[model samples]
Target: MSRDQLVTLAQALRELGGAVPEPVPSGAREDSSFSGGRARKISVSMPEDLSAAVQQRVGRGEFSKYVTEAVAQRLESDLLAELVGLLDEEHGEVPEDLVAEAEGAWPDVE
Candidate 1:
């Protein structure tokens, strides 16, 4: 499988409480305030089966952390998709050679 597919599978496994490697931070953004601030309670309704599955996987009293991680992952995916769509609209599809060049240069530091 491709690296992207593997990554998606790993994230799914994490959300389901399966053993997986800890994710490395992307380094694109850092917001420490969220971690230090108070957390407000929010209610959400889901299908009974999904709720049951989540409860079974994460157990009681841990739903908050599970939901927080799930929401953060989903929001990251949504933002990335939106950014890609906007870039495609503004610049058309990126060229293959340019993509290769960027990939080649990515590993080296000045």
Candidate 2:
């Protein structure tokens, strides 16, 4: 990133009450490997019956990719539900401070 962009981002983060000067990771391949890049290997696990079923339906060659994607989608959905519950607990239907800021704030909004 450019120097000006970095400065602006750090200032925005500070406005949100977080510490500045976090360590930036370097010397790693961080760019997207999308255009004609080599594929990488990944591993996953499943129950014996489920694994057998996937192998039967898609075969070992393509089974890993499909199962990995399914598992990732499931994990994302589970995490979202959990985070929403946590926010509800911390802030109620809406944060009281936010509600008290402006009158008639949420009229007919919800």
Best by lDDT: 1
lDDT tens string, model 1, 1-110? Answer: 22344357557655555455644334212232114244656689899999899999989887777776676666556545555665576669899999889888886733
For model 2, what is the error of residue 47's alpha carbon versus the real structure, in angstroms, after optimal superposition?
2.5
| Off by more than 4 A, model 1 | 1-34, 97-110
lDDT of 1: 0.60
TM-score of each: 0.56, 0.42
* Candidate 2 per-residue C-alpha lDDT over 8-65 given as tens digits, one digit per residue, 9 for 90 to 100: 5555545555455542223212232111223355565668998888889987677655
By TM-score, how accurate is candidate 1?
Answer: 0.56
Against the true structure, candidate 2 reaches a TM-score of 0.42
